[model samples]
Target: MLTAPGSLKAECSNCGATHTPLWRRGLNDKLNCNACGLYCKLHKCLRPKSMRASHGEGRRSGASSLASALSALASVAAPPPSSATPVVEVVSPGVSSAQCYNCHTTATPLWRKDEEGKTVCNACSLYYKLHGSARPISMKSDIIRKRSRHDARAQRSSLTEPPSASNTPGTPSETPSASPGVSRRPRPV
Candidate 1:
C-alpha cells in the first residue's frame, strides 16, 4: 500500500503500484517499492521545495524545512496589499498652461511659445529680449485678433492725412515779414 509516514498514500505512476512514501531527505532517495522494484523519484516529491529554498547559496535538505524557510522568507519579503489611502492629482482652474520661460516649471502664468518653438514664461519674456531680433512669440488667438484690429485703425488714420501744402510751387511763404510801420524811425529821436 502506498502510504505516507503518517498514513499519507503515495502512488507510483510508472507501475500502478502503491507504497508508503518516506520522508524525502534529498533527490534519488524518497521512495522504495518492493513489488514493482522502483525507487521513489525524490524530485517528484521534494524538488520544488528544494528549488525554492536553494535559490539562496546555502543548501537545504529536507522538504519540510525548505518549505518552512520559503514560507518565512515570503512572509518577510512580500509587501502586504495596501488599502490605507488613494492618491489623486489636483489641477487648478483659470491657470496659465504655459510654463516658466526661463525655468521649465509649470508654475509661471505668462507662458508664450516663440516661432522657434521656445516656451517662455512672462518673467523670462520680459527679462529676455526674444522678440526684436529673435523670432516673435506666438500669442493666443484672441490677443492676435485684438492687435490686428489696432494696427488696422492706425494705418487708416495715417492714410487719411493729406500731403503738406508746402510742396506746391505757388504756396505762400509761412514766415512773417515786418510791415512798414512807424517803429523803424530812430526811436522818436
Candidate 2:
C-alpha cells in the first residue's frame, strides 16, 4: 500500500489517473485526469477519491468505493473530538474510566454504580437518596445544586443544634410564624 519516496504511483479507480502521491507527507491532494478530466483525491485509498462521478465520467463502483473510503476515514477520525454527537464508547467494567449512565457523563468521581448496575452521578444519586427513585433527566442542574446546598446546610445545622431546637416536624415551639407576608416555613438561618 506504500512505497519509497517519489515512488507512490497509484491508478485512480474512478478517474483512471496515474497519481504519484507524497505518501510519507500524508497529503490528500485533489487531481484531475488529463485525458477525461475525472477528479480524484489520494489519501488513504490514496487521494480522498469522490465516488460520485461527473456525468458520463466513470462506473458506480469507483464512486461507491470513494464514498465508503471517506466514511471509513471519518469513523476513524471522529472519536478523538470527544464532543461529537452519538458518541459510542466501548468501556469495560472495573476500569478506572467509566461513563455515568444516567447523564452520559464521564466525570468518574461524580459517578457511582447503583444497585441495579447503572451509573448515577452525584446529583442523581442524591436525588435518588431523597426521593427513593431515579432523578428525572429533565431535572435542571441549577435546581439540583440549590437543593444540594440546602441539604448540606441542614446537615451542618443538625450536627450543631439540639434535637428539639432543630425546627424539625415534632417541634411546635420552633414552628414558623403564620403571618400573611411570611413563607409557610423559614429557611434555616
Each prediction's TM-score versus the true structure: 0.19, 0.25
> Which stretches of model 2 miss by more than 4 angstroms?
1-97, 140-189
Candidate whose lDDT is highest? 2
Give the per-residue lDDT digits (tens) of candidate 2, residues 127-168: 788999877877734433334787899899899976665656
Show model 1 residue runs off by greater than 4 Å.
1-89, 103-118, 122-189
Quote the positional error of residue 51 for candidate 1 in Å. Answer: 36
lDDT of each: 0.46, 0.52
Clashing pairs in 2: 41-47, 41-48, 42-46, 42-47, 42-48, 43-46, 43-47, 51-63
Over the stretch 1-189, how does candidate 1's per-residue lDDT look in tens digits? 235456456543333335323323223443433322222342344223322332222233467656766775676674665787544455687754555444555655457775577786554465456445432334322221223888889899999987767646655545444774334324454
